[model samples]
Target chain A: MERILRIFFNNGSFFTFVGLQLLCLYLIINYNSNQAAIAAETWSIRSGKFKSALTTVNGYLDLREQNEIHRREIARLRSLLPESGYNITTEIDSIQDDSLLQRFNFLTTRIVNRSPYNPNNTLVIDRGARFSVQPGQGVMNESGLIGIVDRTTDRHARVLSILHQSTRISAGLANRGYGTLRWNGLDPRRMTLIDLPDYVPVAEGDTVYTTGFSNIFPTGQVIGTVEKTERQPGAGSLNLTVLLSNDPLRATHGYVVQDLFKEELGSLNEN
Target chain B: MRGNDAISNALRFLLILFLQVFLFRQVSLGLGGKEYLFIYLVPVFTALLPLRTPRPLVVLFSFLLGISVDLFYETLGVHAAAATFVGYARQFALGLLEPRDGYKAKSSPEGKDLGNRWWMQYLLLMVGGYCVFFFSMEAFSPVYWRDIVVKSLFTIPVSWLFCIILVTFLRPRI
Candidate 1:
């Protein structure tokens, strides 16, 4: 080590000579225009090759996350298929037509928790008040209506599931008189249509839809297909246990529907 | 002792630099690329530094003088590099041409002390080498190899005579 140091430095004086010469040359290269351009061009070529090699390594490490984002994207795009074309109008920002003026503006979110078997099932959703998800706004998945927003925090909201004991939506046979849609405590897929007359001509496989009486859901939104009907013991009314299209346990993503004209309609109802 | 030597050396350096930049630098004559002569007189300063100076100090001082000339001429680093090489090589040249009696400690190389023939021989060897190195650097690149040689050949005689006059007149004494 000592011999090497002595030879390298010539006991330090040689070291000083070399160091000062290098510094002067470096200053000359930096201050002179031709030398600066040559240095810059050589530096860029070397650095670009180094960076691309690093990027190849980095790109492989990030592929798992990229795949997951792609999966979510596919799910969001599938919601746009022809069967659910009306659902595309949910974008409030893109509402350029008068037909969309009174429509609910929908913002999609995921269900984080659920009590599907409970007599009054409540759902937890990922969005909250900060996302403009207010109480009374309806929630739906690709298949059909899921619930209504009951309350919210900045990051999450609780939804009152349609299967809840107090849940009611104005629904009826297509082009028929309207009644209430509700669920019994027994089954998740079956919801009942209440207060249709016993002599009503509705049958199995008949489609029930929202009647527009409740400002919460738009008219013609599918509630269910009729599974069975039975006459009430004394009221001479027909009730149904229609199979709901959206099974709460199976559906993971849903949208909170904002009623743009809710305040105006509420004031008119109060008078 | 070091302080006195440094001050005297610094003064000589300034005088040589002024003469080179203001006097000999403007003496380029000839217009059509025939019989052209460009003299460089400042290198005599490097040749006549005190005989006892350390090799490294001589090289360093010569480089500084070269850089000072470069700043004025705007050639930049060409003269400085040439001077440094000459200064470093001077000890080898002296070893080759040393007298049979050897050199005195504090004496300068002069026509009177070293004999007029020895002085003239010293000037021809050192100043001739300086002109070749300087012009080669000025016309850098192997493509201009002939130009550098021609310029140096023409420049040396004129530059050498002028440098001899300057050396005899100054007679630099500590």
Candidate 2:
């Protein structure tokens, strides 16, 4: 018994090492989606608070540019709205009835923290669950679709940027018809639009927009412009290369579009 | 002896964590390749710590360093796994360099200490091991075989180059 005890103690370090490895392996294997969501939310909130405090010190420098951009956006939205006989109560009812349009309503926020360095890059926005921002909401800059909300906390949300490998948006050719917008993780400026029918008249410089198939994004939001197209022989689809509308590196502010019907849509699908 | 060493080691770990999370993370090699070179060097810092340490202590530090990096990199437990692997292999790396008994106190493992020729071998072994573990855990499936190969090949050398430079410049004073 004493000899056996000595042998066990001699190799005790190795056993401990193996035990730790097993623990880590378990962590890796049992890494739940819910845990990831929670972690993402916590990270977003913490980073957002830190970045917001940091950016506030520097925000004054960009005030002129930001004000001009805001004015231009308000003007654009005004132009889109019906000019005559529009009442506030009726508009509110209309917004409620059309969940997609309601879902398109945005909470403007500064990008407190951002990472363009990752294959599945995420951005932190200074707004969150308390502000009604939720996961799977669409995020966009003034130019176009930026990403989708992945997680949210009380004071911030993390957006899985379009630059991420996991980002897949239902997009279609403005000139042609339907396709899936996917990032190849090769070029930040360009993305690939696949599953496009070969017969679609895909011209160079043609615009691409969201199809609104998903509850996340509104229909007709611009995504990018087709830079090149190739018809693969025997394949029914065309390979299209698109230059993304927004330069991720330069974007500082964005809006998170809350998908009001997401719960309803989810429940309906389950039934 | 153990307690003082533990405190200093903890301090060093915190310093490296701050550097990775706040400063080096912002430095990205763009063009959609999706690579962060400077941040990968954080593990090498832990791996290059003095070899007189207990094996369990080394592994513990490696796990701590890796998990801290994972927190910032948003990669979950991948960096933790790779860093621990490198920590385990550090003894073998030293064996391939100088004789185990001939090692000096407070000297960092680097190209100079291990000699330049053997240093390349050491760096390749450690960095290659790190990259393989990192990319494999990240890819996590055989379906992304092409992507895994391409990403690993692109990132490994860049990470190794960063590790070499950092070790050379930050070699501990004898």
Candidate 3:
């Protein structure tokens, strides 16, 4: 027993090291869905509070620029709707008109942090679950489509920015009819719209917008312009380069497009 | 003397944690690759504590440092596991370096006491072990084998170099 104690004391560090390894292994193995849900809940509350405070602190610094943006947006919206005949009460009602309201209806949010460098670049917004923000909600700045909300806490949500390699948005050329916007993970300002047929007449600088095939983003929201087009032999598809309209680095604010029928659409699809 | 030592160690740990959380967390290296680096050498505080420091105290402090970092970084339990491993290995590191006469009284393993040559050796071994353990644990699967190895190899030298520079510059004379 004395000899055993001596040996144990002699190699105390090794024993502790082994013990920690086992503990880590236990944690990894036991990492469950329930635990993750609880963690998500906790993080939601904590991050929500933190984000709210941060926004409040930084509010003064951003007020002038944000005001200018709001003014421009108001002016743009006003030019489409006359002052006398347009009913302000129908702001929510107008969303039902898929054809008429395609150019308008945006939810404003502030970008707290963003990473364009990451392969899976993500953006954090000041709005979250408490503010009706949810996963799959589409986000856009004044210029164009920004991203889709991937995760949401109570007061903060993470956006899978369009710059991310994993992002694939349904897009259509203004002149042509079909394409899908995809990132090759090379440049934040550029993405590729692939699989368009060679017969499609895609001119340089032609506008591209969301197709609204998915319920996440509304139809006709501007994405970018066709920069370059290439027709590879025997491929049967035109590879088009697109320069994104929104400068993700400079975009401090955006709006989340919450589709009111999202839940209904999801339930219908599930059945 | 002991009280002063405790105060100095606490201050050091706090400083390192502050730098890691505020400044180093934002640094990224690779453009489109999986490589990333952060200033994790703050946990080296627990590792560099005097060899005669109580084992339980060292472990507890290391655990606290790790958990604190994890809370800020959104990576739960990972930093705790790595920091604890470092704390555990610290004694072995001291044992390997100490002469037959044992560690000098009131001497910490900073560059002043350990000297440049021994300090470099000690920092490299500890930092290298930490990088391997941290990257492997983070990857946690054979699929990311290449990623884990490359990331660990790339980050260890940079992290160790930063750690050594900081220790040499800020370490008080014995």
Candidate 4:
């Protein structure tokens, strides 16, 4: 106790200096409105930034889990697609009582490889027969239609891109007229919508969509926009130059649509 | 003689404290809205304390005087904290500005005891330290560092000038 007293006496000024400054800080932070407000604001701002940084770190840490949750969410949304349901309202037809059956299921797939510049461009998708990705299933991305699935192994599938020369899409303009969408080998970004009647009042920038004439593609999926309209020398049909919306090379992910009634539709067509 | 010195020091403290809190506090040199310069004479008392005075006594005296001024300005601890720091820093400033022949016995730091050059340097240190520490404590953070720096720059020279004049007048004719 005597030694402690001697220490205090020797450095009394230093101790008092520290003690007084601490007391002043306490008073400033407690009594002064401006200082108190600044302390509170600084604390809240620091805590807010800390929380955001924590959330970002947590998000990065659980990326695989988050990806799985997002994939399930996409699957759930795909199940509710209008094209995936078949209307069963027959002789007793009422708006509220119409029954429907599930007809299509969309399986998400990542494009592993694509050859957009090839005359017969094809895309390789990750999911194949093991994931129930069958031939003739339609593939599309959020931007626009992609292509039809051509063949599948147990683990992967090949897709025939819309940029292929032989690929013909039954496209229409606002249900006013119907035409076939065909790509010329020269340009991947441009396609010709042929067989549309001139009386349909086609104009530039009109949107062309799939007409669902076949079981290949869903109804009203956007194909492209009309660039120009041309008339053959003696033909009554109008050829519309369409600027394709989907650039196949830029597409990294797509959905392969499995139509449940595809075999039945094929058998009926065969009959 | 020691009794007379104590009385004179007490009188000097009261006079500098009153002038700082009342007269100099109201003085503003700028045109309008915001004052560009501030005058602080209280730290001069701390600066001019007798060299023989203990560090703790100087600190305590400065704190009391600062809190007295803080009561008038309604800034409870800002002035007190800055004054305490200046009081603590006084030893360092005096040591740095020590005369070649050393300080005279029983003499305080004033233009009359120390040369005018030493007096000017000492006042500059004390006033500059007071302004910077006071503004920093008032702001309570370095986020307003620009305000602290600009105010200190504008206040130091002006407050130093006023302190010089005041200390010169208050200097004893021993």
Best by TM-score: 4
Q: Of the candidates numbered 3 and 4, which has the greater lDDT value? A: 4
lDDT of 1 by residue, A73-170 (tens): 76776674445567555567655555434456778899998875688999899999888888888888656889888989998999999989889988
Error of 4 at A173 (Å): 33
| Candidate 3 segments exceeding 4 Å error | A1-20, A26-271, B1-4, B99-101
User: After superposition, which runs of candidate 4 have C-alpha atoms over 4 Å from their true positions?
Assistant: A1-15, A29-37, A60-125, A128-132, A135-270, B2-9, B104-107, B110-113, B139-150
- Least lDDT summed over 10 consecutive residues: which range in candidate 4 chain B? B1-10
lDDT of 3 by residue, A157-224 (tens): 99998888888888887764777888898887888998888898889999888888777787787888
- Candidate 4: tens digits of C-alpha lDDT, residues B123-170: 899998999999899888889898788888888998888888877777
The i-RMS of candidate 3 is 4.7
On the 0 to 100 scale, the lDDT of residue A139 in model 4 is 94
In model 3, what is the error at residue A239, expressed in angstroms?
63
- lDDT score, residue A198, model 4? 76
| Residue clash pairs of candidate 1 | none
Please report how far candidate 4 places residue B66 from its true position, in Å: 1.4
How would you encode candidate 2's per-residue C-alpha lDDT over B7-70 as one tens digit per residue?
5556567766787678777876635666533336666655556667766667777877887788
**Candidate 1 C-alpha lDDT tens digits along B4-54:** 265666777888899989987888876586545787766777777778777
Native A-B interface contacts kept, per candidate: 0.00, 0.22, 0.20, 0.58
C-alpha RMSD of each candidate structure in angstroms: 21.7, 27.2, 24.6, 10.9
DockQ by candidate, in order: 0.06, 0.12, 0.11, 0.47
